[model samples]
Every structure is written in structure tokens, then in C-alpha cells.
Target: MNAVAHNAQSVINAAGSTLEFLSFTLGKEEYGISIQKVQELRGYDTVTRIANAPEFIKGVVNLRGIIVPIIDMRIKFKLGTPSYDQFTVVVILHLENHVVGMVVDSVSDVITLTPEQIKPPPEMNSALATDYLLGLGTVDERMLILIDIEKLMSGADMGLAERSPA
Candidate 1:
């Protein structure tokens, strides 16, 4: 077989099994979430804080006239106090019939990960338990904490339906 034919077979052998991760940084660590769930990326905008809302919630913002809840991912992950600055961005995610925004320090880029590239969570306990993490991606010298955004930002704890503030 020619070299091209051999390469084609190799590619086919790795089919149906790759996941793309949207990578971003929180503090000094790199993290990733499945790209399929992300809707869009918006610059850091002024948010209207809701009274009697959870602390992790950044607030509500008018996303093109549609009200969307903004969540501080750093707070959700219990990393540290979140700061709003030039690098801060709101990443809109769609999950389970709800559209919400997640705040991140900075966005790196979208990365493709095959099953082989993903690794299990660390045996020791982390600030974030394994339940919140999908897995870990070890690429070169960097470690990407794979986060399940839907599970992390599910409106369940946010009490979204109980209050309507616009």
C-alpha cells in the first residue's frame, strides 16, 4: 500500500472518538470544557446583580435583549475571589433548556482531544471533586482540568425559576 493509503486507514481507525475542548485559564491553571455546549463568547459586560441571589452568580446581563444569568466560574470552582478586568470574558453555554454565561479569566483556544489523550482524575482530593470534573487532559507539559459545564452550572442550585429579575 502507498503511504497515503496507509495514512487514510490510520485516520479511520481513530474515528467516532474525538472530543473538542474549549480551553481557558482560571488563575494560573488551564481548564477545558466540551465545545459542543458552548454557545458564544462575549466580552465582559456590566451585569445587574439580583437581590437574594447566590454569591457565585455574577448577575444577569441582557444578551441581545434576552436576559441571561452570568456565573463566576472561579467562584463555582472555589478557586479564589474572582476579579473583573480586561481579560475577563463571558462564555455563553447552552445546557438542559437553559442558557447561561460563565466567566473566565481568559480564553486560550479550542483543542481537539481523542480518548487516548484524556486521563482520569488525580487520586488525591482536589478543591473540585471528581463529580464536577469530566476528566483530565495531559498535553505536553500542561494539565487541562476537564470540567462538565452543564453539571457545574445547572440552574438547580441557582434557583433560577424561583426568581425573575430583569
Candidate 2:
């Protein structure tokens, strides 16, 4: 093969191999979710409260014509009481058959991680459920807790949806 043909093949191979994560903060720690699931970002706004719902489940919001349930990640992770500040934002997620919104302290940016950059989750009993954790992604000196957003959102404890994800 010609040198240019080899380089072109290399670029094509590399382009689709990387996965993107939308990085956000809950407190001091950083977390990431699949960028493919993210629909859009919106500033913190009032949500209609759901009676007798979990504290972490902030409530529901009318996004366009669809009602989306907003879950506060900070509260769910037990980081601390969340304050609706300028930095507070909600990430609209497009899950199977429905839409959900996740609230975080602030959104950093979308980061792409190669397969080599992602390490398997530690084999230790931790506060956060290991099942929902994707792994640790290293970018430069920063470590991001990559989360399986779909699994976490669709878990039995979530109570946000009736039908289980297939």
C-alpha cells in the first residue's frame, strides 16, 4: 500500500474507536457519562415536586412538551445538599423509550478517551455501586469516574420508570 493510503486507513480506524464522555462535577470529584446519551444542557430551574418522592429525585420539569424527571447526582451520591447556583446545570439524557435529566454542580466539558485511557474499576467494596461504574478514565493528570448512566438511571431503586430497560 502507498504511504498516503496507509495513513488514510489509520485515520479512519482511529476516528470511530474513541468514546466521548460528558464530564461534570458533583462536589470535588468529577464524573462522566456517555456523550451519546446527552441531549442538551440547561441551567438549574424550578421543577414541580413529586409528593413523597426520594430527596435525590428533585422532581419533574416540563422540557418543551415532554415532562422529564430530574435527579440530582449530588444528593444521590450523598455529597451534600445541592445549591442552585449559577454553575448548577441539568443534563438532559435520552434513554430508551423515555427522557431523563440529571442535575450536577457544574458541567466541565466533553472529553474523548481512547480504549487505553480507560481502566477497569477497582475490585473493592465502595460506597457507590460497582455495577453502575464504567471505569476510571485518565486524561493528562485528571481522573474521571466514568459512570454507566443508563444502568444507574434504570436501576430498580430509581423509580423513575415503570418498564425495565431491555
Candidate 3:
């Protein structure tokens, strides 16, 4: 085969192996949350810090006059202390009955994933608790960590019962 033909074939192979990820940086690690869960992405804006809330609860933002509590994923995962700068962003997520925001370092892009491109997380990868991870996906030669948005947004830690006091 000619050199030009061989180079083109290589490019095709590389493209075929690429997977899509909604990439964002948490601490120093690049993580991927499913694009399906994402409602919108916005630049870092002033947050009305709420009192008596968890430290990770960065507070509420007036998104189009609707209040949304922003959770810092770094703190939620107990990854490390979080520092913010110009690159910080808030990713709004839509759940069953509500919409919440999660803060990440920055958002990269949306990439696609294939079956063979993903693998189950290793045991003891419990930094953020691998139980919440659907799996790990490889896209563009990088690993996109898949997260279960339902599990993260359900407020399972709040221990709020469905029925109120009668």
C-alpha cells in the first residue's frame, strides 16, 4: 500500500476506537458523567451560600430565577479540598422530580462509548465509592469514568422517608 493510503487507514482506525465522554476534571483526574443526565452547562457564577448545609453544598444559584443547590463533586467524593478559578463550571443535572447542579473543574466535550471500550472498575477504587460508577469507558485514548447520576442525586444520604408524620 502507498504511504498516504497507509496513513489514512491509521486515521480511520483511530477514529473507530474513539468513545464519547462528557469530560470534566475533578481534582486532577478526568471524569465522565453521561451526557444524557446533563441538562445544561454554565460558567461559574455567584452562588448564594446557604447556612446549615453540608460543606459540599456550595449553595444556591438563581438559574433563570429558579433556585438550584450546587454540590461540589470534589467534596461529595471526598477527593480533596477544592479550589476554584476561572475554569470552574457548574453542570446542571435533571433528575426525576428536581434539577441540581454539580461543580467540576471544567467541562471538556461529549464523546461516544462502545461496549468493548468500557470495563468494570477495579475493586477498592472506592475514592468516590465505585458503587456509583456504571463502568469505565475509553475514548480518545483516555478513560472516561461513568457515573450513575440517579444514585448521586437521589439524596440517599439524607435519610428522608417518603411518608411524613401523620
Tens-place lDDT per residue, model 3, 1-166, is 4333343234334646654458898977888776767889888788898788888888888878667878888898788888888899899977655678899988988877765676665556335444456567776668777666656566566322231321
Model 2 lDDT at residue 97:
56
Which lDDT value does model 3 have at 68? Answer: 80
- Model 1 C-alpha lDDT per residue in residues 36-141, reported as the tens digit of each score: 8889998898889999888888789988787898888788768988888898988998776578888999999998877677765555445534455666787788
> Cα miss at 21, model 1 (Å)?
0.6
RMSD of each: 8.6, 8.2, 10.4
TM-score of 1: 0.80
**Candidate 3 minimal-lDDT segment of 10 residues:** 157-166
Q: Is candidate 2 or candidate 3 better by lDDT?
A: 2
Candidate lDDT (C-alpha), each: 0.76, 0.83, 0.71
Off by over 4 Å in 3: 1-20, 125-128, 158-166
Best by TM-score: 2
Report the number of backbone clashes for model 2: 0
Pitting candidate 1 against candidate 3, the one with the higher lDDT is 1
